[model samples]
Target: MADGILYGKPISYFPNGYPLFIALLKLIFSDALVPTILIIFNIIFQILSQYLFFKLLIKLNLNKELALITLFFVAIYPNQINYTRQILTEPISLFLLILSLLMYVSNKPFLSGITGFLAAQFRPTLIFLFPLILIHEIISKNTKKSFLLGLGVILCLFFFKILEYFNLILPPDNLKFNLIVATYSDSFNINWELARSKLSIIKNPLSVYINHLITNPLDFLEKRIISLWSLWGPFSVTHRGILEKILIGIRFPLFMFSIALFLLRKNLLSKNILIITYLPILVITFIHTMFFSQQRFTFVVEPFIIMHTVLYLYSFKGNFLNEN
Candidate 1:
């Protein structure tokens, strides 16, 4: 930030929105105060995320009590709370995504697109959702208006890439880097040392990545499945006590059951609007699984997951316990 502000250099390695957010804070407060302020800001977003999540549940036809139960889960979810302490984009981006969904569900496509675009700036993986939205719009024959809304998102993302192309900001190479790591990292039987050495010397890592996929198709597919499993798998925190483990274990089966019910019973994409709204989850899941596997990267979709899960559990009434 100092280098960018002082030397007028474009910072590109990460998305410009988040670093600029930090820079603005640094301008107002000292370096020591910045982390504190950022964390506070993240906490505020976390609260807002839960609030909007409650609204989303209501929009989904869930009763207020059921919505409140979902909100409780959002508030207490360890992973959701854990990320807020760190000065990362997930908290804010997650909040923005929920807000975007709210707007979309409320029939404000332009505003939803704008908010979603901002969220994408914070986390570029979100750009994948826009294309899915576009596909939905076309399939539903929403015509130029819907197409334009989707185009707005594409334009916002393209603006950033254009800036990168001109060296106006940092290069957005994280996706490429992650792809290289996913292909050649130790998970695929290539040790980090060797992978790092190869990547370090490669002039065109993407080409090599493509070649690896061509020659080792099974490895690529296997790694993506492993990534998906990790994303939705049991919640395990390192160095936690037995009680924590037990709680997570208890939640795991219920969570899985909820997901199963959602996939089998819920017509999430049945409506045209819903198709455009929630298609991002499927698109993002595939992209994240293919290129990266961090739980944090998939955090934006958790509120919906929790909401559906809670709704399913609540529907069972006492039967959920009786059967168990």
Candidate 2:
């Protein structure tokens, strides 16, 4: 809640990796420069992401008109743009995830391994893609190669974790409780701690699976819309009028539409993005249980998931295309 807590001290909003990223940047530049550079970099990356997405469409054999319209929609996705500017881990992680995916689509397994390694640093959950990548290896009959690549990724991650320790970037946080404390400083929370304790409902398959289906719609909506303004809650308490409530409640319509299109896409059932997008979600929900609940936390994987929707929309030959 305090600027002093976030900027002056260690800000622990997420895992140690993102904080490590911030620390790495600060080692080379001043704080004032970090935000400015991040803002500029994000804008550039946003444009590049648009271009690459269009290129991806072209690769998938979409028409030029269709590809450009797709690009426009992605470019104007306000929630995504806000995410890009936040100096957070999601943007770069998602970018690299898309890169690895593109490389995979282009017949480059090695590059996928490399990009996935980089993306893992931005979010540990990225490792969940290993199963799918392993399947790719098996499909290619390169079992040994897949195993070794995965091993290499694990070793590299360990190397970074070790380096972080040597540099004292990831000390006490290696202990989950301390990490949570470091991630977002608050005095303490009886409610969160209680909810986190009861997260074991996930260990039971029937309950977890059933609850996931029943709660997913509301959970997804609340996590997206309500999560945003909660960050600055004390700062903006009285400002939650109807429109603000809607915005805060639902993320952005484009993002929701993107998600909708993805879920409806029949092709996704057989797509590689399933591992990168859908399965990780199940695992994450189980693991986090009741501990944390924010759309942004899950949003790290949104773009890759979004591609499925975008691709599906393309198949429809629909007229949702925006005029530029």
Candidate 3:
């Protein structure tokens, strides 16, 4: 279905206007190898992305081995593998998203804007980060120039949203944001989130922020007790029973390592990219899981989650790290 719309003569399954840049190229070439070529280009992007991530990781004082391990995990993440073959937005979105973080960390605020704006093409939802990043700029005591560039980035997103609204050009769907999930959730526990929002307004806000930080998860566990352990393996879909799926859910836990690194290495501020990358995802998923769906909503965080999972593996020497 995705391939046909991308390669065949029709619209895509979802409103993936962002990928049309590649699609139009495929259309112009009119070759059966279009998808192959697209994937190949993404492969190049993957390599460059590794280098970029490594550069940032190194700058942040992480061990090189940790950086490599992180890159490895991101490379093989299963959901990414299953999705990249078609016109889906996940692959490119992952690339641009990470690039934005790398750019931000390297002190190249303008490039971050460009990369982040490009990311909006993959997932317009990133515009949500503007307020947060502005908070970062203010907290960091950035130069006025940096602050302006940050606003420029937000304006860039606004421009894209306008383009999408007019149908003049299709950036990703800014309007596609799930308001029900972002604002209110169906989950039984609202205590932490309610506290997080309130504390953002108070003096000495670190405690509440820390509490929110401690609980934020970037995992993709299926909500089934059975599937959680088997989540990434071939066995996930094999168990068809409702009760079994529920069992699988509990097994899926988030990458739960950022705080450990923050503490063990005393790297709380240096690892801001990791923090920035995961927090919005946590908030978004918390709402959606409560109000709309289940743990699979974790896919929103898949790209960064994979990156961290990759990094975490290097903590121990393993056979998995030796593969191509």
Candidate 4:
């Protein structure tokens, strides 16, 4: 798709934000060099993400040692390193997401909103949490900042509309497909014909979901539960190589353990950090439960998970004993 775009072909599928970015790179350099360039950029983004994450921790007043430890883990994280070799949106989206949070915590709302908008373009899953952030700003009486943030998002939307009008890119048209797919467990083999039949009538994904919930509540609940588990499930043993399997096996347990500790010690953490880190994880998890869930979808929030977990461990030193 990116090659097609580079060759001046119209993108008939979903909006090609990430692909467009890749195509633009290909335009600047030879096609053969594009892959290498992308990999390097991914690595750079990963490093910058770590740096921004450390800054975020400091801004939240977390202990320097704990923040450094979290930074080390994020830098050496297997999935983060592995993703740098692929031409996927994860690395860039993760960087932008972390940067957006950092900007927000630093009270740079306009910059935060702009970065957040870009992150959503690369990974639309971020869209689910934007409203929650806006609401938080309003509730905290940061009216001026909220307005600036809203304006930033609105301006981005307007630019997108202009590009869409020019037929440069198409808006996402996968909600029905995602909604249909969400009805089944990741392990289920889907019948495309039956899926298409359902999709043909699904004008509203929420309506379809509600109907499914009303008609077959148990099946709906079961499938959603399975989807939730799949989001955090370890990499497949049969499909992945031994090293990948071993790395994920170790990482999976640690991720879960951290999450457990975060939940238990959340009260000792900063509310701003909680809103920026913990809430997005929950929002994404909930969104995936209603749509299609995948382990890769969790990548965007993995850093936050690490940050929350490390902050939780840091709390045991009684540093936050006076915190409400």
The models' CA-based lDDT, in order, is 0.68, 0.53, 0.51, 0.76
Q: Which candidate's TM-score is highest?
A: 4
Please identify which of the two predictions, 2 or 3, would achieve the higher TM-score against the true structure.
2
**Error of model 4, residue 41, in angstroms:** 1.4
Ranking by lDDT: 4, 1, 2, 3
- C-alpha TM-score for every candidate: 0.82, 0.62, 0.59, 0.87
- How does model 2 fare in lDDT? 0.53
What are the per-model C-alpha RMSD values against the true structure? 4.7, 8.4, 10.9, 3.1
Off by over 4 Å in 2: 1-16, 60-63, 144-148, 161-168, 171-241, 244-291, 304-324
User: How much is the lDDT of residue 121 in candidate 4?
Assistant: 85
Clashing pairs in 4: none
Candidate 2 contains a number of clashing pairs equal to 8
Give me the displacement of residue 64 in model 2, in angstroms: 4.0
Candidate 3 lDDT, 255-315, residue by residue in tens: 4453343344333333464455566565444444322333333444654555454444444
How would you order the candidates by TM-score, starting with the best?
Answer: 4, 1, 2, 3
User: lDDT value for candidate 1?
Assistant: 0.68
Q: What tens-digit string does per-residue lDDT give for candidate 4 at 64-166?
A: 7778888888777776777778888999998999898898889888888888888888888788677789988899898999999988788888888887687
Worst 10 residues of 4 by lDDT: 183-192
What is the lDDT for 30 in model 3?
64
> On TM-score, who's better, 3 or 4?
4
